[model samples]
Target: MSTPHPHHFRPATTHADWTKTDQYHNKYLLSQDEALEFALKNTDANGIPLISVSAAQGKYLYLLAKTLGAKQILEVGTLGAYSTIWMAKALPEGGEIISLEVNPKHAKISTENIAHAGLSSKARVILGPALDSFPTLSPSPPFDLVFIDADKDNNGPYFAAARKLVRTGGVIVVDNVVRNGRVADDSLQTTDVVGVRKLLQMVKDDKGVEATTMSTVGDKGYDGFMYILVNEGI
Candidate 1:
């Protein structure tokens, strides 16, 4: 085993920290609460405000889908289906995306949102435990790209699952890695942060992949960090 670089050990981005800063998360990451509510009408929540992903992350992933010429993609999380729209719309002609969510209400709303976006033909919304379903997932992954944004505790399992599903040259993008920069500090024991750090290590040790974590983009505010793991490059 190779020794890990000092910088690879960092914290995960906690959703809690993001919600604390009114201006940071509200105006930037998740900009359209009202529109999101309308778009994600029945997505497992109160409808006042939704748990959509950061705009920065959503746009980035969408661009990656186009850039990678991704035809088949899998996302671990589908909160209200807000992020699914960004990904599904980016799929190339005949391309497809399958998103998994545990919440039945959110799944129904997401299905509706995809239809509203006129992308039902290219997207599939599954309402069940992604963990159980992941092992049985077939057509043998080699998925062009995979995004991990679901439960924090399952991140390591998701990482292992990513290795199994993504193609040799594919990419896996894990979100919210730089939570409040508290991840950089060792004192914190938040589930996601700790889990993300461990996940980073697994990717770093795998000689078959190349990886890096990027902090937030638009604002100096901690938008989030992504660990881009690519197989076949190393």
Candidate 2:
């Protein structure tokens, strides 16, 4: 008999179950509050896609930034400014975050939301295609951390750009890298999958980055993220 493929195995928990359990635990551990709900409502009222990171995930980003003591952060997507508000709250005085958004409408709405969150001074939404806007960005002190949660089809290029923008010892996080575990299938070569694979290969080829991917199942489904730590002298 032939050996079974790893993908054939059943998961111990369903995505819905995991999301519910985790979110519940997160509320207890991380102190769930209303500010995030307010942001969601702001985006909803604006007719923006209800696709901002989940409450638990937003908290995770906030904690990560806080742990890094990040002074300059770069975020590639500012959907509802939900995540922006989370990270901005973690910033110390004089710390700032630049978030890139493609849609002018989205940028405007995000700016309003950021201001509503009382983070207008620390978070700024740059309006334009992230790929085009990246070149114009000249962080005075270089980004201490970078978060890419934009178009998955261009993850490879985004990763390249983020690598250049971030300083040594900085962190780079790429969201939705797993794409419901489609990344493991060689037969499936969708544009987003191809882009993710290309980025994985680039990380493998580049010695300067110490990277790893973690698979996650949440309310958004079976997507995951890539975490990278930039080594010195790159």
Candidate 3:
């Protein structure tokens, strides 16, 4: 083992600190939104899991889609449509996003939330497994951005499908890849961690894409996203 750099070594930040920082950033950078608040409240009322992206992360997704001028987007999961609404709000007229949800309850609630956000014209939630929906998406317009946040155990398959669905120069984002840092520990072989590892290995062997992992610490604890840009020439 190599010696660690003394100046770089430091105690890990606590979850409380991480949450405080997220709150601070959200208060200053993310303005209050009635639609989003309502969606969250409705989700809670319906007993849906509150695993949607944080405000800061949602804004990041929004900005990413806006920056790309994405006309078509695909989301592998639609939990209450919180993130869907965020990204949908960034779309221009005629732009559309299709979100897939395996759970009927989640899909129904997501549809309602999208309508509540006044984004019904731009965002649609499909009730079905993402793998099944992927096949039906063919022959349609290629997606400019694909966000995969569904069951982690199927991440490798999701990435493979996303590669075929997304257009050249498009981006694919896989969330919760770090799984509280368990992904890197050999002893931690949870299904989620193994799925992420498999996706990483596939990305490593794929020469047609450029990809990187970004580790994040926030209210959601330690996790990360794997971002891949499809470029056949690369």
Top-lDDT candidate index: 3
Q: Rank by lDDT, highest first.
A: 3, 2, 1
Local distance difference test values of all predictions, in order: 0.73, 0.88, 0.91
Give per-model CA RMSD.
8.5, 4.3, 3.5
State the lDDT of candidate 3 residue by residue for 1-234, as single tens digits: 989789888688899999999998888899999999999999999999899988888999999999888999999999999999999999999999999999999999999999999999999988888888888886256888989999999999999988888888889999999988899999988899999999999999999999999999899888999989998622
Q: Please give the TM-score that candidate 3 achieves against the real structure.
A: 0.93
Model 2 off-target regions past 4 Å?
Answer: 1-11
Q: How many residue pairs clash in each candidate?
A: 4, 0, 0
C-alpha TM-score for every candidate: 0.77, 0.92, 0.93
lDDT of 1 by residue, 67-87 (tens): 888888988888766777788
Residue-wise lDDT of candidate 2 within 1-234, one digit each (tens)? 999999999778887797898777876877755666788898999899998777778889999999999999999999999999899999999999999999999999999888888888899999999999999988878898899999888988988888888888899999989988898999998988988999999989889989999987778788899999999523
Ranking by TM-score: 3, 2, 1
